[model samples]
Target: MATEQKILIIEDDTFINRIYKRVFSLSGFGIELAQNGEEAMAKMESMNPAPTLIILDIMIPKISGFEVLKRLKGDVRWQKIPVIVMTNLSEKTDEEKALNLGASLYLVKSDHNPREVVLKAKELIDKQIV
Candidate 1:
């Protein structure tokens, strides 16, 4: 069955965001894009159903992804939604920090292709359903 699951992508790179949007859409998930941290926060606040998952990049402008993750995990309304940190930062400390801040998973941008990322997202969403 087609899923009604929606994914919010918070990335500053237009090309990367488009790739994710296309991959996730083709995989039967709805998609939303936020070009910066401020826009991401606004979208999260205003989205009626919220998103089933969030794919975040740490280097986003206006606010860092770590801060966004902190807010999302801290808020009761959004804490349950899974967040995947997808970024070029492959440092061990960065990964540790993201996990400590409540990211469900962390994928280095160069380590996973768009399709692989989408598959992982699908798996996470499916788990949420159960």
Candidate 2:
């Protein structure tokens, strides 16, 4: 079913954002891009339907992704949304921290390509639908 589901991508690298936008777009997902936590918060505030999924990078300028994630999970409006923390932070502690902060999943950037990330996101979204 093609719903109005969209994906919000929070990444500092323009190149990575482009790649993700292309892949997710090809897969029929609407994409919103934010370069940092501040932009992300602003985007979230202005968004109408609220994104179904958020892909976040933990190490961004202005504000950290952990802080963003915490705010998202704490807010009643966005609390139920699923977040995927996709970063190069490969430390087990980092993954644990993301999960502890209520991320639905944590991914190491080098470990998954854009298409794979899309697949994982689709899977997570499907689970939410069920």
Candidate 3:
């Protein structure tokens, strides 16, 4: 039931968000969007049955994506939701930091093609479902 798979995307850029929404939709995944970390958290709190996965952007307004990841990892209910960190920041330190903070996949937006990113995300989600 891949179509039933719900994904939450927390990104500040409207263009990027639209791109992601289209990508996931094309892949038959149910997608939800949040403009900021705070809005993402609020949406998570109210999401029915929770989300299967989360696509997070490191640099965002209101609250940084790292803070959101930290909070999600701390909460038992949401801790199990696999997070794919998608950011333009390609530093080794940043990637390590995100992994240590509980991100399941850390992807450099500038390095990977959109299809590759989507494939990696599907792999993570499939692993979790299995």
TM-score of each model, paired residue for residue: 0.96, 0.96, 0.95
lDDT of 1: 0.92
Per-residue lDDT tens digits of candidate 3, residues 47-94? 997999999999998889999999999999999999999999999999
The digit string of per-residue lDDT tens for model 2 on 29-96 reads 89999999999999999888899999999999999999999999999999889999999989999999
Residue 74 C-alpha lDDT in model 1: 95
Give the C-alpha lDDT of model 2.
0.93
Q: How do all the candidates rank in terms of lDDT, highest first?
A: 2, 1, 3
Weakest 10 consecutive residues of candidate 1 by summed lDDT: 1-10
Q: What TM-score would candidate 2 get against the native?
A: 0.96
Query: Which 10 consecutive residues of model 2 have the lowest summed lDDT?
Result: 1-10
lDDT of each: 0.92, 0.93, 0.91
Please state the error at residue 80 of candidate 2 in Å. 0.9
